[model samples]
Target: MSRRSLARFVALAAILSMFGTSAAVMPAQAADQVIKIGIDLPVSGADASDGIPTQNGAALAVDEANAHAPKGIKFAVDALDDAVGGVHNPQQGATNIRSLAADPAVMGVVGPFNSNVAAAEIPVSNESGLPLISPSNTNPTLTKTAKYRTAHPNEITYFRVCATDDVQGKAGAEFAKTLGLKKVYIIDDNETYGLGLANVFEKDFKEMGGAVLGHDHITANQQDFKALLTKVAATKPDAVYYGGTTSTGGGLVRQQMGAAGMDPAKVKYEGGDGISDAEFIKVAGDAANNSYYTVAAPNAAKSASAQAFINAYKAKYHSDIGAYSANGYVAAQVIIAAAEKAIKANGGKAPTRAQVLKNIQNTSGFKSIIGTFGFDKNGDTTSPVIALWTIKNGAQDFVHQINVSTK
Candidate 1:
């Protein structure tokens, strides 16, 4: 059966008839089991542009999972907002995970796109043995921490389908090297993702034998970037790398870079996945052109599966897909796949939280719209590929692929 076929999932439903033969392993409340996957996202705030698409992709995955749910279990989603006033709040993210952990029905969670939010959410999720799978969190520290732990506990079960900032930032730096751009200035949004990405870029760019002019951090959602842009202009560097998202002043930085007389093409501009959203093009207008960004998800225009998702997404939401849509979809797929494996291992009985988490951590060769990928020992995707994009005509167009490594 085709993996993408929604009807194919109903085959699992057929297993319901066979469950009666395995009564010894069935849980006491098996008849009332309702499997749920919690979605924590910044659906209403600053990340709404990316968050909405992330949620849309996840919703589709949930629909498919339910269509294929095994007997005695009804699959559903318990989506919650982790945003406050349209911005990701670490505290809110933590609270959302705690609530999900408290729910007995929730089998796993997919969300908290922002890296800073994931940092807060991880500890809470680990405490309750809830596996938190992120569709967009890319800070390398989460998985790259010293053996057994970094800032988090050894029992942490956080995982991500997206490429971490170390890989993405290195791609950006390498792309800059190809452009022969020297003397680059770095600016970040002062958040976990942004700063972490900036640091990686700075290190990689310099290591590539390029000159690093300076670096600084900016406030999130600030309208005025003229002063910073002016400083960047004074340096007259070959490029300005802003490690931030559209919601975190990426557009203003792009716009002001142009307004400050920094030629978009000559000086060049680059950012990590944070600024790759359509909103960046909208917010920066003509100035967005010629800018560069890196994304973990493959280009939808090139992948057939991605094209199908794009069409379905447009039909359902009447909106174009975002950079993180495929990531979110795959995140849900991973969780659903793990749950399926756990269910089978339990002889058609519902699996425990630990079982589900273990299955996810050991996932390998899972196929999805973006392509086939699996989690390594660190709970990060085994795929080390990152796609680069360029802005043209107020849209992010796929440029090419870049293989990156993190030190």
Candidate 2:
């Protein structure tokens, strides 16, 4: 199915809608080429526990795409590992981007989950004109700020399905206030995502009239946060806010906090999406309770489509999905939509990079497993809903959701 053909079918569907009839958007054509959706992930090492689920989600989308693609529009996924030394590395991520963008078959990419990796790869992808959609990079500046435009000048190829850190940070701060946490200590793993989120949370908490006791930076992937926990315990904060992923010591921090004699009933634990995964509970063990988390996307159980996605994922991979699985799935869906539009618009031919990019930028009310959303001028999601959740009996339980507006 060429992008040019998609237009004719869409117009037909729209006309049918007026007549109170609608049609599913699927077309079959015979072509000799295959379009590849590149997926960059930390498939090996510590973060792989988090990144693998995202990869599995994207892979599921890829499989569905291939099954339904027009004979002329075959789709595939090229998943590359961006992890080195059991963690996310910006240099490795950048190298992966350079390689993926060099491939002619790759129309777009669907990963680089870590914000630090996204920060590293964005410029390289922009230079190569390869549009990249991230499932888990929540750093605000990636799209919500001018950092992309500042680096690329006339180009903007980076996009994300997750809410920005600022949104999650503000919401977490609000949750802290709601829990009567006036004094808090902030800590981050010093990665681009964690450190930036911590900064946003600290600033927002202060603005809400909460007192910030202090801030600390921890080494990524360190198992022993006992020394740091001991220091934080002395501050007598009402709560401790950690702005880092589970792979970057979130579990250790929580466990060590308990070891340091912090009263969870009073000294609550607040964190962003990094600590909101099932893996966190497995790692933190009994120390996972009394923790609250703010995530950019809702839990998969909240939607029928998302549940179907989970079922299909389990049916295929024989494992459960993770926190960012829906994110990766939606990101791939966005790219697939663009590919369809580009092919239909190009007179039944394979879509060009510019065509796909333009279509993605113009996507509106694109309903996926995650939710209905479209990119704004900055390639940020126009309708962003964040969720507040907490661990209950060894599971992440949702509390509430809020629509976060950039304005």
Candidate 3:
């Protein structure tokens, strides 16, 4: 061959090699396009204790999903703080939900930790056909209401990964009764969650031959609980049940009682999941010791899968995962798994909100970092477990995992 002809052949070979290399890189690059999941939780302000951990858990799940890259589909989390301005603000919750729902890239949402927020966001979410799985919203009214069922039949996009307050309150009451606590002073924050749980505890405790010494109401933002504490102290009850978030509950536990002139060890202060956060330690200080609270058992980090998740979370974020972090992570897992299932069923197309909702409802016996998770017809987890914890040395230490008798 002539010199010019040989050079032309070499150039053609070089062009083909470049094309081959480009084709090889395209698939990996295509896999990098992530499916975004919306995370609406309280990352700051009053509810940050629960909301931040919930967000962290969701982030952990997103990281795992991306690392595993199931079916070449990457997962991305878009976190929004519902309690950015303050806690228990329905308007802020609605705003956050609307903002997330407006994003076409967001296939589903992982939170809105407060039941009141869930109540507010349900209508907006239903209108947008957005599937929202809450890790902590346990109010029965969210799913059981006739209005909610009528408006969102077959398309019920709201689901919870934890047991409702009915179960939580009953379990808590039973636990206290077992401890031989006869007279209990009950207090609530007046919000949907606080009031609802308080009612449940009151009814159950009464039924179990326990006496209600007194009942009081407290606002969410009130820092001065001395008046209520004084009343409770006067009652001389065996235990004080606080139905509110850690922000108020912890402060009341620390400042109102204990070294602040009240005998902390003499009276047991019990609360629901709201007071189960580590912030309770900071707020309650030494009073946190021996303080008992109830929370979703599935959120514990003791299981093998949970420990794995915690390790991965720590490795990625270099921080301690909070109380509800594992539950939120599992919530994200449910959403992502459903999305993947829907996508596969739709012949590699991204899932529709409706399809994803169905997938979430039908999802059963799936292994998660929080153990087995599956929802029943009422949008409640089938294996709902409640755990009691006590504050020890300014930290929440697992005490007993309450086996839920109710479905």
Candidate 4:
């Protein structure tokens, strides 16, 4: 060959060799790498009963996401215990966030399951520009704050799969009104979640012209609420509103009310999403019967996508799906979808945390197992559908799905 032809051939060979080297390195990079997702839930304390399942649901989602991930990326979940002693402490939640944030590998976070915990940890994630999607946190104050807007101006980094307490409390009040409840006693656990939700319910119930017989507060770890129940029973209220989780508040519903000589059927009990679980039914037992709860709309298990998820979850874990599991799964789905979009937008390169946050905030009308989900400007789920369920014969049966809007 002539000198020019040989030079061209040598250049082509050098380019081909570089391409071969890069191709060989790509699979090793994919295999050795992982996209980290942080999970903060009370996995080892009093709240573990609720938290463990949520963690499991999140893990299941991660597994499924990895199994179906596009050729170049794999997902890994870093499940951290936010449970401190017997409580889901905000300090612990914040610590978890700091730890996750310090690691540059984590693209997003899945929780701090309790709204109380979210109150502490979300700001940290916000400062770090890490998108934190909560599966269960419902406090309205989270997304309504000026700080949230100031910190996350481009897109709301904080998103939730569930409806907020503003919607949940209103749904509870409406349900009580529908039942013709005239007078009700409100009790809260004094935590961020309990107090916030209780206040909302109390306001709405009273504004509806219903009577608020009395309101009380209790510590979350307290086991005895007989004195409070006695005072509430003396008020002759038609119903009682509990604003806390099953771990701290469920037994009070049955034991304290029974000790006060109040017949379970005679007094209606209502609570927010915290008490809407199978564990609450177990803890409250017979008292749980006829009790009502407000929760995010029930997973339409009949939907083909939902059923497929249920089946995959059951087959993988050999456990039945619970009230919060599907929500947790959907929360993971949202994060993964956002990450995938970000990666694609980055031309097959892994996205940085800022890019992921932007992608998540810009996520509009993404199809999820729960339904079509999009966040409002405030980071709240735009789909404000709450479901009222009644415990009948030891099972929570769906009563009605209420479509609510602040407008």
Candidate 5:
């Protein structure tokens, strides 16, 4: 052979060694089409315990989807923090949604954990035709009332995986009765979610023949709840129900109960999903004992379909699932399912926001690790279920779960 022929043979041998014999016959793989899922939550401060796990759940879904996504598509998470000064801020949530909406690559968003934040972001997402599926927002007016729909009444872009406060509050009231607590005092954080949940709990508790000694509201981040606890102690109530989250005085109220001579051990404390966080326990300290809370979503740990998800979640995050973590996963599943449908209809191209939105709205009978359910016309979960939990030994312990009738 000539020198040129010998060099060519050596180069061919190197190529064969690099890729093996099948490389010559196999076609080149196409680059994956990237689709982004935006996550908006309070990822810092007191709420980080809940926010981080919720984001992890969604991120886990993205990881799984990317691993098994169609031959030419991939998923990514664009998580953005909507917390200002360590708490969830509505204005910040609105800004985050606007930013996500501006990104053509972001097909959907999962966030605004607090209901109040959801209220501010709904209008922006509606106008942008971007879907906001929440893992924890549970205020009824978000979907039941017309106030949030003023921007675009014809189009509903907000959805959630959890039951609304109306159902959760009623369930809590019923649970209180079951616990043989006849007299109760209610306190709220004077915010949209807290106040609304308190109102429902108060009304239902009264209707069930339970005495509501008194109801009070506290300012946000007030830091001092001694006066409120003093008044609550004077009532001699069997239980003190708080309608708020840890960041908004849920933990402080329980902790101050002891300072006001209302031993948390003797006086049972209860609250909604707002207070159902690890931060609440940490802040409440020894007073965390005897504190019972309700979650607006079904018990994922109890769901037979959820075992696999629980295993997968633990494997990825190396921690137990948070209250709304499964809800976050389900929310992401809804978005991914919708994206798949939209992409298929669009001939395998990146789907438009409107296309994704329409597909999301059409989601029905979708089965997830949590359960089989779908979005109703109002974009609320058809599975309106709530779970009860308590703090035992400074950690969360599942009590029981019940399904609430939305009708």
Candidate 6:
């Protein structure tokens, strides 16, 4: 064995060792490609019962995706609260979306539950070319009207999985009539969502030959509603339809109706999805009886496809799913499908926000936990459904669902 031969062998061995190390290190580095899904919702204060459950649904999807993610891909959730004090704030939502958009790793977003917050965040997200898939923004103006688009009216970056107010309001009015509610009074919170729903319900009720005794708007944070209830009582209305959320005076109005000479159980109390939450029942207490409401999405808990999701949700959060929880999961699923496509198109690398947005816009035949649906040109769900609910024995009971009619 000559020294020269031994030196040559040593050099070759070192080269092979270094090559082996590089091969092992490359996969670990590639596995670090983290794609984040930003969740902007009112996850604090009174809204937590709704927002936290919705956020939990998205988070649960992320967890499940990571379990089966491709070798070099991983998913994460970046959650931000848009709640200020006790309710959702538009400015906070805009700020949260801007923060999420500036992050290059965030491929898409899944929230801003309230329609009003969505209105404020849409322009910002659209300007940034960031995709936002909402679980619950149901106001018609967010997608039907062009004013909220900022300067990019033609380019849609916001999509929602829920039915719009036009359908929900009409459904509420129809249901009221079904209960023989002939004369009714209407009240709204004066916010974008509440006022819009109230107006639609009013028109539909009138067209259905039901008398609208009077209509009113409640001021923000107005605690004492006895005066308004007294005025409403004077109309001798057979029912009172509130077009606002529990946080925005839905439960309070129903609770105070007795002081205004109307028995909460005898006189029908109706509202939109805003009041179809556990918080509403908590707020209205025993007065919650005889209360009817509607949800913009189908009854996910009843869907066979959603059973696994519901069980997973309960197992993870140790609580029942909220009204929009499955909708949130569906929104995340849409983004996940689009992100997977974008990554493959980019050769297994993280894709650009624009690429992901374009893929989401092209989402078709998406089978979600809720149902089989796709996004229309306006970013609205191709199949829209509304669920009716009632408070019975101090719990939410699902009545039935309506397939929204465009006409």
Using lDDT as the measure, the top candidate is 6
lDDT of 4 by residue, 25-76 (tens): 6754335357888888887755776787777888888998887786678899
For every model shown, the clashing-pair count is: 3, 14, 0, 0, 1, 0
- What digit string (tens of lDDT, one per residue) describes model 5 on residues 46-139? 9898899999999989898887776588999999999999999999999999999998989999987999999999999888888999999989
Q: For candidate 2, lDDT tens digit of each residue in 1-407?
A: 99999999999988888766333444444455788899998878667788899999988898998877755678888889998987788999999989988888888999888898988888888788888998888898887665655457667788877788878888889999998889999999998889999999999999999999999999855788778888989989998999998888887788778778786656788899888766688888877888899988777777787878888999999988888888898888888889887787777688887778778878899988777888877777877778889987777788988877643
Candidate 2 — which residues are off by over 4 angstroms?
1-31, 148-151
Candidate 1's TM-score reads 0.87
For candidate 3, write residues 37-77 as lDDT tens digits.
99988878767867876788898788777766656577788
What is candidate 5's local distance difference test score? 0.90
The positional error of residue 352 in candidate 2, measured at the CA in angstroms, is 2.0
Clashing pairs in 3: none
lDDT of each: 0.82, 0.84, 0.79, 0.80, 0.90, 0.90
At residue 140, give the lDDT of candidate 1.
87
Q: Write the per-residue lDDT of candidate 6 for residues 25-98, one digit (tens) a residue.
A: 78544346899999999888878777998999999999999988766889999999999998999999999999
Which prediction has more favorable lDDT, 1 or 6? 6
| Runs off by more than 4 Å, candidate 4 | 1-30, 147-155, 405-407
Ranking by lDDT: 6, 5, 2, 1, 4, 3
lDDT, model 1, position 161: 82
Worst 10 residues of 5 by lDDT: 398-407
Clashes in model 1: which pairs?
Answer: 9-68, 45-86, 46-86
Question: Least lDDT summed over 10 consecutive residues: which range in candidate 1?
Answer: 146-155
Alpha carbon lDDT at 399, candidate 1: 82
Cα deviation at 170, candidate 6, in Å, is 0.5
lDDT for 377 in candidate 1 is 77
- Which residue pairs come into collision in candidate 4? none
Model 6 error, position 108 (Å)? 1.0
